[model samples]
Target: MRYAKWTILTLLALTVFGFFHYTLPQHDIVRIVNTYQERQDLDDWTRIFWASPDDQATGLINRDVQFIQAVDADGKPHVYRNEDTGWSWPPYFKFDTANLQTQAEDLKSTAEAPKWVSVTHYGWRIVYLSTFPNAISVRPVEGPDATIIPWVNIVILTFLAVILFMLRRMWLQFRERMIDPMVEDAEEAWDSVDARADQAAAKARGLWGRFRAWLDTWKGRPRR
Candidate 1:
């Protein structure tokens, strides 16, 4: 039982970690090699990995998705799919798909004179599943080794921590103000019932004593 409990907890932790890792935005410092658009078939399970830019276009099975190809400072190639999140789950509110693609094209450069840029995106590059991270934004940096602080992640985590703390405090206040008082009232009612029962028993004993004394007078002639 103990092992099972630990295993369940571990699985839950991993699931949460994977959820955030896939959904949260991350930074990759790379030089843009190229940008292009291709028609992708989205009629299978992989459809979940792609974006639905329009509500009216849900019936369509295929769409042209723009892609950004780049190589990192270490010369490792990375590809990002540029698609608008459009009022979707990650809530990036990014509606500048075309504009981002144009910017990526402008930043494209060869290895001889590399133009280092930071790609801020979310999702994962699962080779087996053919999944690519959705690029949220792009900006040019000083160089490939330039450091970028994840301010968005820091702010989001801090806000979540504050919300959890506030909720805990509210629960404690509810117990102190409402639940505790109700419990005390129930205890007091039970004590009152017990006191009433004791009084009833004492009154019954007193009546029995008076009856016994009255009966003693009837036995007086026999005693003489």
Candidate 2:
């Protein structure tokens, strides 16, 4: 049971970590290499990885998706899907897919004359599933090694930490002030019941002993 409890806690912790990692915005400094549109099939299991911008698009089996291809400072390739998140999950409210694609096109450059840009995005690139991170925004940066201060992420993480701390404190207080006393009272009630049961048993034994003494007396045996 103890091992099972630890395993559950471990799994819970990993799940929370994965949730935040996938939902939270991330930054990638890279040089725009190319942009294109491709019809992506959404009928398979990978449908969840794609964006559901509106109700009409939800029923479609395939749709044209804009893509931004880039290479990072280490020459590592990155592909980002350009799609409007609408007013959906993650709540990015990105409705400028065309505008972002245009921006990426305008910033395209060769490795020799590369223009560094910071691509702010969320999600993950799983090659096996053909999943690409959804690009949220993009802007020109000084260079490949430009020190980008993730003020948004820092603020968000800090806020979440504060909220979690407050919630934990509230839960602890609730258990102490409400649950603990109720549990103690129930234990005390159970103890009282046990005491009554023991007394009743003792009384029954005494009555039986007296009855035996009387029976012995009737049988010509002396009583103490």
Candidate 3:
């Protein structure tokens, strides 16, 4: 039973880690290679990974998604799907998909003269699933070795920790104020019942003793 509980807890922790790792914004320093628009078929499960265009109908099964192609400092290719995340999960509130694509195009550079840019994005590029991270913003950087502090993630995680702590304290207070009193009342009631039972037993013994004494008085007397 203990092993099962630990295993379940480990799995839950991993799930939560994976969820935040995929949904939270991350930065990648890369050179913009190109930008393009392509029609994407969203009739399958992979649709969940893509964001619907800001002006498109939610029920539409197909739409054109803009993409930014880039190469990292290590020459590894990275693709980002550009879309508006207005009023959606992650709450980026970005409505400048077209503008971002244009900026990416303007910043396009060749391998000989690489203009490194930091691409802020969320999600993952899964080759097997044919899904790309949605780019939230892009800005030019001094070099490929530019450092980012990930302040957003730090603040978000801290806020969540505070919330969890508050909830735990609230639960403890509830148990102390509400549940503890009920348990104490139950214990007191049981103690009262035990006392009554003991009193009744004492009274019964007294009555039995008196009757025995009365009978003993006639023991040596004549039958007449």
Q: Pick the candidate with the highest lDDT.
A: 2
Ranking by lDDT: 2, 3, 1
| Model 2 C-alpha lDDT per residue in residues 1-224, reported as the tens digit of each score | 99999999999999999998988899999999999999999999888888888644578999999999999989899999999999888889999999999999999999999999999999999999999999999999999988888888799999999999999999999999999999999999999999999999999999999999988888885667
Better of 1 and 3 by lDDT: 3
Better of 2 and 3 by lDDT: 2
Q: By the TM-score metric, which is better: model 1 or model 2?
A: 2
Q: TM-score for all predictions? A: 0.75, 0.88, 0.79
Instruction: For candidate 3, give the lDDT of residue 56.
Output: 72
**Per-residue lDDT of candidate 1, residues 1-224 (tens digit):** 99999999999989988988888899999999999999988889988888877552877788888999999989899999999888977888889999999999999999999999999999999999988999999999999889999999889889988998999999999999999999999999999999999999999898988899889878776655
Q: How close is candidate 3 to the true structure, as a TM-score?
A: 0.79
**Per-residue alpha-carbon lDDT of model 3 for 53-107, expressed as tens digits?**
4667878888889999999989899999999988777788889988999999999
Candidate 1 vs candidate 3: the TM-score winner is 3
Candidate lDDT scores, in order, read: 0.92, 0.94, 0.93
